[model samples]
Target: MRSSFARSGLLTAGLCAAVALSTPALAQDKIKVGLILTLSGPAAALGQQARAAFEMALKDLGGKLGGREVELVVADDELKPDVAVTKVKGLIDRDKVDVVVGPTFSNILGAIAKPVTDAKVFLISPNAGPSPLAGKGCSPFFFATSYQNDQVHQVSGKVAQSRGYKTLYLLAPNYQAGKDAIAGVKRDYKGQIVEESYVPLNTLDFQSELAKIAAAKPDAVFTFMPGGMGVNLIKQYKQAGLADRIPLLSSFTVDESTLPAQGDAALGMFAGSNWAPDLDNPQNKAFVAAYVAQQKAVPATYAFQAYDAALLLDGALKATGGKTDDKEALRAAFLKADFTSLRGAFKFSRNGFPVQDFYLTKVGKRPDGKLETQIVEKVFSDYVDSYLPECSIK
Candidate 1:
C-alpha cells in the first residue's frame, strides 16, 4: 500500500509539470492581429474588398501566419477619425494584439498612426499611405503596403504630359490625400492649370464641380474622387454631357471598387494604378483567379495591397521564427520583404512604402462581361516614392 501511494504521488507531480510546460507553448503558438477599416459608409466597398482579400490570403495560408495560428479581430472605423482612434486603442489596450492593420482613408491613418506607434506595436497600412507618414512623420513601427498617396497621381500626371495635354482641370476632396493628389499631378505636369477645385470629402453631389469643369474647359479633367463619390461623380459627369467633350484622366475615381457602380459610364476611362487584373505574372494571375472565383468580382488595388499585407506579416513572422516579442528583429524581417508580391516586383523604400511599377490602366469589358482595369502600359518601373530623402531611417 505504501509503495502504491508513493507511485501515485510521482504520477501527479509529472502531470502537473507537463501541464505547466504545455500552457506557455500553446500560448506562444498563436498571435493576435487587429484589422480596422472603413467598413461602413460610401467607401465601404473598398474596405470590404480589403477585408475579403486578407481573409482569402489567410485561408490560402491554411489559416496560419508564419506557422502560428492567427487570432484576427476586425473592427469598422466607419470612416471616422475619432472612431478609429478609439477602436485602435481597444485593440492595443484590451485585446493586446501583436500587430495592427488599417483604416482605409488617410484622415483615419493620420488619427491613429501616433497612438499605435506610440505603444510600440507594429502598424501596417494596406491602403491610405498619407504623404506625411512617407516623410517627416515616418515611424519605425509604421509600414505601408500601398504606394505613397502621390505616386499613382504622379503616374496620371506623366501620362497627361506625354499625351500633350496643355491645359488641365483638377478636382479632389478637401483633405490630406486630396491635397497630395493635386500636388502629385502638378509635380510633373508643366502645363496650364485652368483651375483646381477642392470639395468636401464624401460629397455625392458633383453638379457644382461638373459645372466648374465645364466652365474651365481644360484640355483634360484630372480628379481623384474615390468610393461612392467616384460613382456619383462619374455618373454625373457623363450625365452632364462632359464625358465626350473633354477627356477624363483620374486616379482611384474609376477603379474596381467603384467600377461596378460606374459601369458603362466608366468604360474606356483611364486611371493610374500599381496592379491590374491582366498584369502578367504567375503570382498575380493566381491571385486574380482566386479573387474572382471566391469574391465573384475583380480585385482592386485595395484588395491586392491588403493581400500583400497578410503576406508581409507572414514573411516577417517567419523570419522572426514566429516571435513577436522582439520589435527590432521583427522590423528588420519586414524590411527584407521576403515574399513574392502580386505586383511582380515589390520592395520597401526607405520610408517603408512600396517601390514598384506604376501603370496607365484602362477600364475594359472582359469576355465574360465583367468590367476590369487592364494594363495599358507600364508608366514607371521600380519607382521609388519621391519622399525617400526626407525619411530619417536608412
Candidate 2:
C-alpha cells in the first residue's frame, strides 16, 4: 500500500495536469513558482513577513515576469523536516513548479536538498544558508539570497573583538545551525568564551540559562536565537537586571520583527545582518516604504531577503524569456545577479552563498518611542563566505 503522502502526491499531480490540459485556451505561458515556508509554528512570523513582502514584490512586477503570467503556489512546512521533504516532492511532481523559493529553516532545507537537486529544480533559499551546502556539498541549483549561517555571526564576533570585550557568554539552540553560529563567533571573537550554553529548540523558559549567564559574569553575551526565542530571552534578561551590565550581541536575534515585542528590553542590543530597514539607497528606500505600507511594520532581514529573491527570479525569467524548462539558461541568468537588491551591493560567492555587506544594527526607539532597527555601522564590507574554497563547483 502506498503511504498517504505518496497517494496525495499522485492525486495532486493528476489534478494539476488536468487543470493545465483543460484550460488550454486560458493557458497563457506562465512561470510556476512554489514557496515552502514554516507558516504554522513558533517561527511562523518569519514566513508571514516573507510572504507579505514577496506578494508586494509580485505586485511591483505587475504580477508578471518576463512578459509571462505568474502562478504562485505556497505551502506550509510547519517547521518539520519530514513535512518539508514531502512538500518539496509535491511541489516538483504535483504542482510542476519551475522554481522552489524556500524551506526557511536549515534542517528542512537540508532534508529536501537531494530531492530538489535530483529533480534539477532551482532552489533559491531566502533565509537558510547552511554550511555544508556552501562547502563540499554545494549544489549548482542551490543559491542563497541570505548570508551563510555563519557569516552574519562572524561579523558580530569581529565587531565584538574590535570593541575590546575580553570575555563572552554564548547561547544558542542545540542544532546544526546553532552550532555553526557559535563556531563563527569563535572564529572572529578574540575574547575568551566564559561559558557556552545550548538550549533545546523552542524551549521557552530561559530562566535556568539566565541564571547560568549571570553567574558566569562574562563581559558580554552573544546569541543567535531568532523568532519567539529572542523575545523570551531578551525579556528575561531585562527582568533579571542584566540588560545594562552585559551587552547583548547577536545575529538575527534583535531585529525589527523581534524588537517590537521586546520593547525597551531589546534596546541597545547589537545585531549583524545584510540589510536593515533604514539602509540608505533608492532601492532600499523604496522597499522600506512599500513594505511599511503593506505590512504596517518595519521590514526585517527575512523580508528583505525574500523580496530580493523575487526580484532575482524576475531578472532570471526575463533573461530566459520565461522559458523555465531551459534549466541551463535560467541557471546562467541567475548567476549574473543583475537585479537591484535591497542591500546596496549584492553578489554570490563561487559557492552560491552571498558576498555582501553585513551591517551592525542597533535596536532603538523611534521619536514616537516605537522600537526599530538602525544601521549602527558596517561590520563587514563586501565579505565573502569562508566556505567557498571548499566548494568544488566549477
Candidate 3:
C-alpha cells in the first residue's frame, strides 16, 4: 500500500511540472507590437490620427492579427529624437516586441531606424520616409507604408508647373524633410525660385516669411509646413492678405489634419497626397465611412497610411502562419505586400518604399459642413521614388 501511494504522488508531481512548462510556451505565441509616435506637443494631432486608425484597424481584425492575439504597447516620442530612441529601445529590449511602428516626423525616423532594425525586428513607418532610407541606407527590416518624403512634394511641384507659375517662393521648416521637400519641388518645377526660406521647426509665427513673400511677390507660394505649424501658417497667410494674391500650393500644409483650425481659410487650397477622403473606390469609401463614424472627424493621410500599415502586418503575419522567429521569412512576407491599400494599387518598391499613385487634392467644405480634402486629379500613376535607383537592395 505504501509503494502504491508513493508512485501516485510522483505521477501527480510530474503532471504539475508539465503544466508549468506549457504555460510559457502559450504566452510566447502572442504577437507583441510596439507603437512609437509623437503623441504630445503641437504635432500631436498627426500621431493621434495614426494611433487611432491603427487601433481601429486592429479592432476591425477582431483584436488579433493572423489569428493570434496581439499585445500593443504605445509610446509617445514628444517630437524629440532622443526621447524616441530611448522609448523604442525599451520596447525592443524590455517588451520584446515583434514589430515597431511610427514616429510621424522624419527626424525621429532618422534616430531610431538603426537600433530597431539592427535587432532583427521589423520597423514600419506610416509616415516620414526619409531619402537616405530609400537610398543607400535601405535596410531589409525597414519598410515605409507612406511615400518617400519627396514624392508627395514632387506632385505639388508638378501642379505648380502645370498652373503656369513662373516665379515661385518656397517655404518649409528647417529639417531633413524640409530639405527633401525643397528638392522635390525643384525636381519638377522649371520656374525661377524668387526665394527659398526655411523656418525653424514648429515655428508658429510666419509674419517675417509673409513679408518676404510679399516683397518677392512670386506668382505662387509653395510650402511644406505640417501640424500646428500648418494651422498657424494658413491663418497668418490669410490674415496677411496673401491668400487671394499669391496662391498657396503645398503638400501636408493644408489637409484634413489641420483644416479644422484653418476653417474657410484653406478653401480651394491645393495639396499633394497619395489618398484623400473623397477618393472614389470601394475600399476607400468603406474606410472613410467607418473613420468618420467612429472618429467623428475627417481622416487625414496620416490615418489612412497607418491603417494600411496594420493591414500590411496582418497579411505578412498570415503568410508566415503568425511566426516571427525567422526574420528573413517575415521580411520576405512583408515584401510581398499582399494586402489591399486604401490608396488603391500600392506595391513596395525594391527599396521597401511604396510604388503608388499620387493625386492633386484640394480642400473643400463638405455638404455636411465639414472640411476635407477632395481629389482633383491623378498626378502620378505607379510613381516610384527617384532614389530607388540609388538603393542597392536589389
- CA lDDT of each candidate? 0.93, 0.86, 0.93
- Taking the tens digit of each residue's C-alpha lDDT, what string does model 1 give over 228-307? 99999999999999999999989999999999998999999999998888999899999999999999999999999999
What ranking emerges by TM-score with the best candidate at the front? 3, 1, 2
Among all windows of 10 consecutive residues in model 3, the one with the lowest summed lDDT is 1-10
Clashing pairs in 3: none
1 against 2, candidate with superior TM-score: 1
For model 1, state the Cα shift of residue 47 in Å: 0.3
- CA error at residue 183 for candidate 2, angstroms: 1.3
Q: Name the lDDT value of residue 191 in candidate 1.
A: 91
Error of 3 at 130 (Å): 0.4
Please provide the root mean square deviation of candidate 2 (C-alpha atoms, Å).
8.1
TM-score of each: 0.96, 0.92, 0.97
Q: Write the per-residue lDDT of candidate 3 for residues 71-139, one digit (tens) a residue.
A: 999999999999999999999999999899997999999999999989988999999989999999999
lDDT of model 1, residue 276? 89
